[model samples]
Target: MTVRRPIQRFYTEPAPMNKLGKPHLQVVRSISVGQAPNIPDTDGVNEMLAKAGPSATLKDVARGILDRLVERPELEVQVEEILFLKDCLGASLEWLCSLAASDGAACFKRPLLWSGWCSRCDCEAKDYLMIYTKQVNANSCPGTPGSRSRTPSVAFSRPPSWESLDANILEDFDKWDFDSFQLSEATKGSPLHFAGWKALGGFLGEEPSDVFLEMERTSRFLEAVEDMYARQDTVLYHNNVHAADVTQCVHALLLQFGFAAYFDQLSILALLLGAIVHDMGHDGRTNSYHANVCDDIALTYNDISVLENMHISKTFKLMHSDPSTNILEGFKLEHRNRLRKEMVEVVLGTDMSSHFGNVADFKTLIEKLGSDPAEWHHEPKAMSALRVMVLHAMDISNPAKVLPLSDKWSDLLRQEFFLQGDEEKRLGLPISPLCDRETVRFASSQVGFFTIIVQPTFTLMAELQHRVKDVLLTHLQTNTEAWEARKRKEQLGLEISQALPLLKIRPLESTELTDLAVFPDTGACLFSPSRGGSTRDVPCDSQSHGQPRVPAVQRNVEDVEGSDDETALAALAALACCASVEAQVAKGFHKNRPAAPAEAFALFY
Candidate 1:
């Protein structure tokens, strides 16, 4: 008979052979120790043994390999674990664990764990690993790592507890100078993260533990926010600084009117988050520019609120891109859905095109709720409308800030507008209003923007938040006056340039001479001794003067040169009226009775 060695089958290493000539199943020794001894592979014998008894088969070996793989500390195992957890606990809890893992919390203490017995199993059991947090003045569990047996001897200053935040704190918000809260000084690189944490802790009355967890996700979310705004496409103005400014302003506004008390924690969260991300990934261009150029963003959003839609959608996409930054990680499915809806609404409301409609809605809500604070406190829809309005107000509040702050923001905004104008010129597109730096006066543009947009928006806001009326109106008036003063200064400079040639200090250049024909009555032929020019005179009533003639009124050259700016302006005004009268006489207007200088001055002024 031919002798053939028994095949090793699935085992990589050969099993030890017993004296009886049967192979010992070394891999299954622990599990099948109490089972029947291994038998030789014979057709009838194997079938009889398989039918007769339960044995460790190829299935047992495969199960053992899978269990070991799941427990291994490898990237593959981590990916598998994530998929498994996601399947077991659904997306929300899985997201929370993912963020916790990124924050080092899951590394030290497994985020998804259970120490209690399973009701279904009815036996003593442990699922995953338990987290043992260090506690002050608490005894350490014997086997727990990083547990404290005693409180720390050193005292530390902690943030105020939620219970300590009262009406007094809310009332004091109006006095707080928001400019003093610089993100560079306070948050290092994450102002929105800092603002979100403080707003939740101080205003929403969240516990320290809850705030700490929320901050983990907020920090992650802010990472994405920072990255998006740091891209090459991002411009100078609509960046992280602007987002932080709006967030801080929203927080202040919430406290200003006690909206914190009126809205729930979720609503407040949405409002603050909305402010922080309302302008996310702004390309420093307006929606009109996008639509006019048929840009991808405009086409995607159907050319309506293009930038706003892009900002909000990109924000949510970043929030889901990583587990670490998912701000709504642990929220219930319904709450998460609702928060997203509300946040999108609030962010979309920031579009300037929707500003008046949102303000009108808010005003109608306020009217329905009545002027009483008590009545306004309980209506959810009204409070939501107010929240949207508050965020919108904060978005546009930069121009209403104090002079120094507003001027800085205005300069940055003008630079951005000029850049767009440059792009438009390059593309042969019509330059947008207030975008052409060569033609548009910054101060005059600001005056129009303030009067047409900023003033009316804030006026409505002031009316709604009565306590902030004085503060808002004060800053609005101050900023408006500043812009108006700048406009007047600019206008005065232009008038001086136009009047310079009329003074006739020297012979007119070609451009100046051309300007002279338009002002026939103001074309004087007085020579300047200071300029070493010979004296000449011209009659004001002459239609054309080929040669200089003596004027009806003569003044000393020394007196004219020594006159103040006000005197020069007055002379220009008088000459302007004279030209107006000449033109009217030429047209047979007021022909019978020419108006006097005083009457013309009154009409012109």
Candidate 2:
């Protein structure tokens, strides 16, 4: 049977020299020529090209062509023509020279050609093409006598071995200082990339070559993640550092809890990858905020785990667009499909809305296992549940960390919330609770969150893993205590401010105390002048009489007594003594001076 191959029809026209003084071939129009029976599915190929757009550079076209050729090897001739045209258009020889230099022995090897449709434009408009020398042994290269081909420096040369990632290291995850393992020079300020690469490579037990390849791919992916996040309107709480923290936590959980045994290499890969990209492309806003405002992402996901869905979709889209960063490119079709499904579900589970549900599911799974580790170990459903639950736990595990780390994350989260609150206020929207800086009490909110959400979750996890119970519970207890102490201090300060008036009193000018009358109803002090011996009233309201009414001080004292705070009592006592001495001095002065007319009387200090 004669099968027709897919044809890409392109209407090419001569264009003026580009800025680089090179002849440019403008693609006027493009259309799909035809589909060949022998051709494989070209959707992935087309998608990659489309991402590059219609006005792609020669380098872009070359990459697209190579990607398509990897999937469909039957389109050689058409690809050759595209390459020839690219060369005629003054395509740089730098890439070819670099390849030749690197493959010193294979410089004279016969060039391999491949062709496919340019997925960006209509099938007829642009053809994908590339030409490369076949792989050859470096030892066979005819270089200068005695000259040697330099070997490329390998990242993760001393990656952690699977055997070393056992219980001890897993338990040390909380104590692990990720920055200490960073290759600052290689990662270019992205220590997390190196850390993730080491952890992933170690967990998979990959050989040096395989580990190096995967590391390169993962590094590229991490770079892409960094770039995507850099472009996002993200806050400090959901940035790259937080994502890396979560990823490390997830890795630790898998190893620490012995959950690594249940997951295959592919599953572990997906879990680690999911953790790294779970919060990608965050817009520094909550899902509720997005849904309430009808944001584009909310509408796209129909308000169903909007932020999570966006993160997963954006991550996958980025992976598909860039071959260098497509870490799953080597996976089999079924493995890749499973990876995508697992990654999506796990990442979505990171959303706080699903937290309770995940915890509930974990509990149910544990109940089903019923003290039998053997039964749970091989059960796929249980393992899957554990996988997601672990990720969920890690996502909210900031409070489960040691004091200093926990405090840092808490402050960052509060800052993000306050920023959102400011925006809401500006937009005339009702601010969300724990977001409004004017009203939200940070210590109180954290206390409630720990008591209500974090403590219970970690407690459940601890119950499942008796060995880790102390570690989890200890941190939770310390953090709870810290917040509680803060709450109490804040309350005490508030009471002290209210009680200040109790100690501020004015002394009566007359030595005779029998006429002293306190009017509780009117909060006034009645005094009789020594000269006329007539009673006169002074209001305690500071605004009205330039002096506080005596009744307000009594009220403040009553409040202080009701509080039953020893500190408050001591403060009140000291203030009362000061007030008594001032009054005595004033009375002595008034008695020493002759009594004046009532109209001329003045209140003493």
Best by TM-score: 1
Off by over 4 Å in 1: 1-176, 180-182, 185-190, 200-213, 230-234, 372-381, 493-568, 573-605
Cα lDDT of model 2 by residue, 357-380, tens digit: 878877787777864344675787
Instruction: List, residue by residue over 35-108, the lDDT tens digit for candidate 1.
Output: 11122232323333234333533222222223444455352322222212212221112222222111000112
- The residue pairs in collision within model 1 are 537-549
Query: Between which residue pairs do clashes occur in model 2?
Result: 9-124, 30-125, 31-124, 31-125, 32-124, 46-119, 50-120, 105-141, 540-548, 540-549
Residue-level error in angstroms, candidate 2, position 366: 1.1
Model 1: lowest-lDDT 10 consecutive positions: 123-132
